[model samples]
Target: MHFVTGGAFNGKSAWVKAYYHMEAEAVGNWFSGYRGDALPEDLHSAAGVIVVLEGIEQWVKELLMEHDPKSAQDMWHAALEKWLQWERGQQGRVVCLIGSDITKGIVPASEEERELRDTAGRVFQDTAAVCERVDLIWYGIGQQLK
Candidate 1:
């Protein structure tokens, strides 16, 4: 797995695209939460060698809406494991998870919002811990962290 993170309006998506060699044809393989795409339950039948899950923060928010914090965390780990399995099943397959850095903002006043914010950090950590490569995008530049 590969993880990419940065603040909103950063070049995360573009950097990821070029780094992964994702051309225009790669659009079909991209599942974006920004467009209301659901969290992937399975990718065994996915066609692309690189699977891109963009706007992961939105997906995390959706997950938190249905489950408690702990359960949501577990659910994310489970999904990551599933994606790992899928990636390992093929020689060239890769899973790319892109998330916005939500931890830099002020703590939200609403308990629910706060959970989402905190969980975003946890989610990024969870991904970073297992990812083969981690990167941060800033102002259209990508710096590798792993």
Candidate 2:
């Protein structure tokens, strides 16, 4: 699994598409009304294919707003665990996770917003720890982190 992270409009998605020889449609928009308890089952079929999971922070924000903290955490952990499993199972496939870096700006006054930022940061940290490669994009340039 490869993790591509940057601020909005940083060209992470474009880089992933070109790097993997994938069209825009090949990238899964996981944040498109994607409120769910489990990771999409069809991802299993993505084996030997290049799949990009975009807007992961959006999904996490939705989860946090819709559920209690404990429930949201459970769902978040489950989702990450499922993704990790799928990534491990992909022998010839590529899984590129694209998320915005939300920890760079000023701290939010609202507790909910702060929680979302913290959650996203933690998720990104965990994902990067296990990913085979990690890239941090800034001003359209990718700096390899792992």
Candidate 3:
């Protein structure tokens, strides 16, 4: 699994798409690529899975309020459990793409934004910890971490 991250407009999506295309071509499956809006059944057939999430903050927040009153951390734990269950059922790799600008200014000026930033950071950290490798994209360049 791989975790690819970057700030706004950093081409994280493009990078992931390119990686998938290149890998497909290298393996002689030139037709394979990301289908963002349409979840394909063949996602499990591939050797790995790449999940591109644009708004980690919002999603986590929504999940927290799914049943109301619960904190984001609780929701994340539940979501992780479900994810693990699903992962166990699939023998492919899973990659997650999330947006993050690690700076104080990007940290958000409102309570909502602050929560988002914090959740986004936590999501990135957790995913990266489980992934085989992590990459940071900036100015169309990729820097590998771990």
Candidate 2 — what's its lDDT? 0.72
What residue pairs are clashing in model 3?
48-93, 49-93
Residue 51 alpha-carbon offset, candidate 3, angstroms: 4.5
Q: List, residue by residue over 1-146, the lDDT tens digit for candidate 2.
A: 78899998888777876777666544343322223423453576553556667777876687787886567666766766776777667466666778888888899999999998988888788778768899998888999989
Candidate 1 yields a Cα-based lDDT of 0.88
Task: Give each model a TM-score.
Answer: 0.95, 0.81, 0.64
**What are the Cα lDDT values of the candidates?**
0.88, 0.72, 0.54
The number of clashing residue pairs in model 1 is 0
lDDT (tens digit, per residue) of candidate 3 on 1-146: 56677766777766766866644222211121222222122333444444444444445555444533236655555555454555667566453545455533645678765665666567666667766778888876789987
Models ranked on lDDT: 1, 2, 3
RMSD (CA, angstroms), candidate 3: 5.8
Residue 79 deviation, candidate 3, in Å?
2.4
Angstrom error of the Cα, residue 3, model 1: value is: 0.2
